[model samples]
Target chain A: DVKVTQSSRYLVKRTGEKVFLECVQDMDHENMFWYRQDPGLGLRLIYFSYDVKMKEKGDIPEGYSVSREKKERFSLILESASTNQTSMYLCASSLLDRSNQPQHFGDGTRLSIL
Target chain B: AQTVTQSQPEMSVQEAETVTLSCTYDTSESNYYLFWYKQPPSRQMILVIRQEAYKQQNATENRFSVNFQKAAKSFSLKISDSQLGDTAMYFCASEHTSGSRLTFGEGTQLTVNP
Candidate 1:
């Protein structure tokens, strides 16, 4: 089974604090993604990386950034936490294939900003 | 750009009964993929089913199956013999065959009643 591990299941941060969410995959997949899930908005893409040391902004990347320094690791960074940024964050990975494979996901990190 | 749409915000079904969740997508690409994902209270996003655009037959996984209508740009999920564990938020998503990103729609909250 493919494993996507997020560092934390729940996290709390104060406003103006920097926060990091870590994710690691054992499947050697080349593509990784970060998303925030809200009640009505669903999952909005925050960032995605297709290769090590490469990153691309997604639909809602304004306050988020990603780092993929290794094929197995992807990190999401929030420069400064805010109450509005609190949400369930998810990490996922997929193989670098043209067949459109399904992404494997982690349990997620529910971040709370106060 | 691709877009996914899930019109149903909430749905309920009795245990052992069947329920279908609807999804629609708009894209200009000829080849792509569609998916249905289930997120339980644990908040782990699980891949429920996948459908390739070129496949004429819908995809099925045990009690879960999909009704993929390519021409109509529709992909719906059918859950049979539903159980309490089947209750979750179901999300519809689309991905291009060669793209590394996925587009997700607003989710449908499913409740399984005894």
Candidate 2:
């Protein structure tokens, strides 16, 4: 079975603070993604990394950045957290194959910005 | 750009009953994949079922199955003999076979009343 682990299950941060959400996958998948899920709005992609040091912006990438220094770890960084950023963050990983690979997700981190 | 839609925001069903969740997507690509994911109270996103657009047959997994209508671009999930453990937020998602990202629906909150 594939295991995707997130660094934090819940987090609280003050406005204008820097925040980091980490995700690690044991499957060594080549593609990793970060998404923020909000009520009514659903899950929107924030950023994704296809390989080490290679990142791409998803639908809603503003105020967020990503780091993929290693194959097994992907990190989501908020330049400065705002109240609007409070939401459940999810991380997922998939194999390099794009044809028929399904993404495996980690337990989400619910971030609260005060 | 691809977009997924789940019109029903919330649904309820009695235990041991059957329930269906609807999903629709709009995309110009002919080759793509569809997925249904369940996120229980634990906030872990688990893949429920998947379907390839090229396949004419719908996909099924035990008590979980999908009604895929390619002409309508609709993919609905049916859960038979639903159990209390089946209560969760179900999200429908789609991805182009050539792309690395997925487009997700807003999600339907399913509650199984015992």
TM-score of each: 0.96, 0.98
A1-114: candidate 2 lDDT, tens digit per residue? 999999999999999998999999999799999999998878999999999999999999999999999999999999999999999999999998976679999999999999
DockQ, all models: 0.77, 0.81
For model 2, the interface Cα RMSD in angstroms equals: 0.9
Candidate 2 residue pairs in backbone clash? none
Model 1 agreement with the true structure over B1-114: per-residue lDDT tens digits: 988999999999999999999999999999988889999998888989988899999999999999999989999999999999999999999988878788999999999999
Looking at candidate 1 chain B, the ten consecutive residues that score lowest on lDDT are B94-103
Q: Fraction of true inter-chain Cα contacts (below 8 Å) kept per model?
A: 0.74, 0.71
Chain A TM-score compared with the true chain A, each model in order: 0.97, 0.97
| Backbone clashes under 3 angstroms, per model | 0, 0
Worst 10 residues of 2 chain B by lDDT: B95-104
